[model samples]
Target: MTAQILDGKTLAQRLKGQLQTWLAEVSPQVGRPPGLAVIWVGDNPASAAYVGQKQKSCAQVGITSFGGQFPAHTSQGELAHLIQQFNQDERVDGILVQLPLPADLDSTKLLHTITPDKDVDGLHLVNLGKLLRGEPGLQSCTPAGVMRLLGHYQIPLAGKQAVVVGRSILVGKPLGLLLLASDATVTFAHSRTPDLAGLTRQADILISAVGRQGLITPQMVKPGAVVVDVGINRTPAGLVGDVDFVGVQAVASYLTPVPGGVGAMTVAQLLLNTVQSYGQRHELVMPQFSG
Candidate 1:
């Protein structure tokens, strides 16, 4: 069977529309739009593209975008100072430092500098700890986006077998926790696994977060399983995902497309997180989204 596309692009757009409506109604009362500060270091092309999309999304959703374009040589202390300033800025509700910082920077220390209340990226130790305990808190964007996509389509998670390929703190681990919370039995497969194909073929829901392209072949997937591809790799052939999309689409019951799938949802979730932070800080009623 030809798999149904998961259509993250359409769902993300719908979510953004909902956020915009919520912000329009409340910003006048709050005396300012919800503000999000994005700290981007260096000139990494991919990071630049990611930051651009995020800021653009913020504009669409009425979150003020602050912080931009730090040079590669910018000192760690200088960046941390900015985070401190953002933490204290009453207008700002969310702050995020773009990843893969320059060689000399200490990303962990700098990330820790942002106040948990404004840590909209949800990478702070406090937020991660909250997620670990299955409590309500800010969530990591990509994983949250994946769950959102699945929920949008009304996919069943309870009592299913889910296999996530990758073990990164950012996507894989958080996603596995979310799946388990939904009562799906979760397994994490990584490069070190001796039988990746055997592990993957057991999944009712399969996800690939590894950056390597074509890591999950059609043969590795169980027929009729749901597939979510979280990897974004730039190759000479253009951007691609970890799954062999064309091949896997023919085998799986559902599949997410590379450019329009998880990537779009990630940006949408970032905006959602920013708005959630703003709503909490202001003690204002906030509309909630699934995922």
Candidate 2:
């Protein structure tokens, strides 16, 4: 059978519809729409695209998004001050600072300064700690999006041999944690892993987050394994995922496409997180997505 394309863009559109309905229900009680603040410190094209998509998703869901753009040379102190101000702003329920900040900026310190409640990115140590402890907290959007895709497709995770490639705090580490929470036996592989393809072949659930071009080929995937490609690499051929899609599609049972799969769900989950964060802060419970 030809592998089913996990259409994240379509899924995102449906999820955004749910967000609109949820917002409509709660806006009356809250007396305002949920708000999201996105702060970008530099002019990186890719990051700008990601932030713009996020803001657009917010608008589609009827959430008020405040976009803050800062100069490339903006100091760490200035950035922290903006975060502090957002933390205190009653109108802003979620705060996101775009990643891969300027080379000289202290990303760790900047993440730590955001109030844990408003940490919509789920990068704060406290939030990460909560996830590691299997508690209910805002989860990282990309991983959360991956889970939504898996659930939508009804791919079982319990007792599965899952492998996550890459160890970045953003995608790999937290995604591994989420898989473990679902009762999957998780193994995390990095660039240093010897014979990466061999480890990949053992996975029942394979996720590639390594930011390299066509890093996962057909030979690396086991027959009928589920593959999720999370990389966003730009090349002359256009956007490419970690997995070499043409090759792996022949071998994998399920696969996510680069431009339309994980990427779309990521923004969808960001909007979900913003609404969820708003509900949590105000002691209101939003209806879970029943789709």
Candidate 3:
């Protein structure tokens, strides 16, 4: 049977429409639009593309942009000072530092400088802690986007065997905690995990966030399992996800495409997180969308 596509591109568009409506409704009361500051360090092409997409989405949803690109040699103290400036800016609701910072700059240290309330990227430990405790908080965009996609399709999560391949703090670890919060029995596999196929074959819901293309082949997937490929790899063939999409499509019951799937939803969730922060700052009730 051909797999049903988990079309994140379409869903993200719909979510953006909803956000636009919400922003229109609240901007009058708040007297200002919600704002997002996306700080990009260095000139990484991928990071630049991602930041551009985010800023464009912000404008579409009436969120103001309070950010700019930084030089490659910008110092940690300089970046930290900028983050603090955004944190204190009443017009700014979210602050995000683009990743793969210049080799000398400390990403972790800079992340800590952003106020937790305005940390829309949800990489701050405070928000992650809230997620671990199953409380309401801004979540990492990609993982939060995954959960939102599954919920939208009304996929079963309770008591399912969910395997998350890759244990990065950015995606895997937090995503596993999210699935666990949904009552899915979660196991994390990484580079060192032995017999990887053996673990993946048992998953009812398989999520691969590792950047390695073609990592999850058809043989490794359980028949009829839901496969979400969060990987974005630039290959000889252009862009591809972690799963061998053509092969796995013949086995899995549902799947997400590389560029249009998790990537699209990631930006969508970032907007949602910003709106959430905006609402909190103004003591206004924000619209909450489930599934």
Candidate 4:
């Protein structure tokens, strides 16, 4: 079967439209637009670019974007203090600290320090535990985006066999929980799994988040399986996913591309989380999104 490409760029644009409408209605009631604060430590070029994209997206949706930057050597205490202040800031609804913090800083402590309500990245332990218990909380953006993509394509997850390759907290674990929540039988696999392709071949729905390049080839996919490529690897050939796109497309019924698939959805979901934070903090009605 020839695969139908899931167009995340177009889909994200549509979601942004929904966010704009909600912001128009909700901001007036609150007397201000929802505010999102993004903090970055170090001069990581990639992190800066990611923050810039997020800030631009916030502006488009009428969410105020506040960015704070620090040197690579910024102390853990200083960072924590910043988070504490943002948590108490009446105007700030969502707080995100870019990942890959410098070696000197304790990542775990930093993540735990953010207030659950303002943790838009949704990495705080309290939020993580809430997700583990299947309670209502903002989910990690990429995993949330994956579910959105599935819903967008109307893929039925109930009772389906799903194989998720990867075990990172950022994507794999949360994704498995979401799939399980949807009643899909999920197997969380990784590089350590023997015969990785053998497991992947049994899945009705396959998701690859392993950062390694070309981990899922056409031979690894079951006939007509739905494939979602969540990996983004920069290579000499440009950006590619964990799945071998060209070969897998020939075998899969539906596939999401590397640059335009999960990546775009992640950015869109970040905006959604910012909006949700506003609703929760101010006791305002949650905005609706058709996307």
**Model 1 misplaced regions, further than 4 Å:** none
Steric overlap count per candidate: 0, 0, 0, 0
Candidate 1 is scored at a TM of 0.98
lDDT of 4 at 186: 99
lDDT of 2 by residue, 46-137 (tens): 99898888887888889998857899999999989998999999999999999889999999999999899888889999999999999999
- Provide the overall lDDT of each model, using Cα atoms, as 2-decimal numbers: 0.92, 0.91, 0.92, 0.90
- Model 4: lDDT equals 0.90
* Clash list (residue pairs), candidate 2: none
List, residue by residue over 1-291, the lDDT tens digit for candidate 1: 999999999999999999988889999998999999999999999999999999889988889999898999999889989999999999999999999899899999999899988888788999999999999999999999999999889999999999999999899999999999999999999989989999999999999999998899999999999999999999988899999999999999999999999999999999989989989988997766653
**Model 3 misplaced regions, further than 4 Å:** none
- Give residue 165's lDDT in candidate 2 (0 to 100): 96
lDDT of each residue in 137-210, candidate 4, tens digit only: 98899999999989998999999999999889999999999999999999999868999889999999999998
Q: What root-mean-square deviation over C-alphas does model 4 reach?
A: 1.2
lDDT of 1: 0.92
TM for every model, in the order presented, reads 0.98, 0.98, 0.98, 0.97
Error of 1 at 164 (Å): 0.8
Clashing pairs in 1: none
Evaluate residue 252 in candidate 1 and report its C-alpha lDDT on the 0 to 100 scale: 98
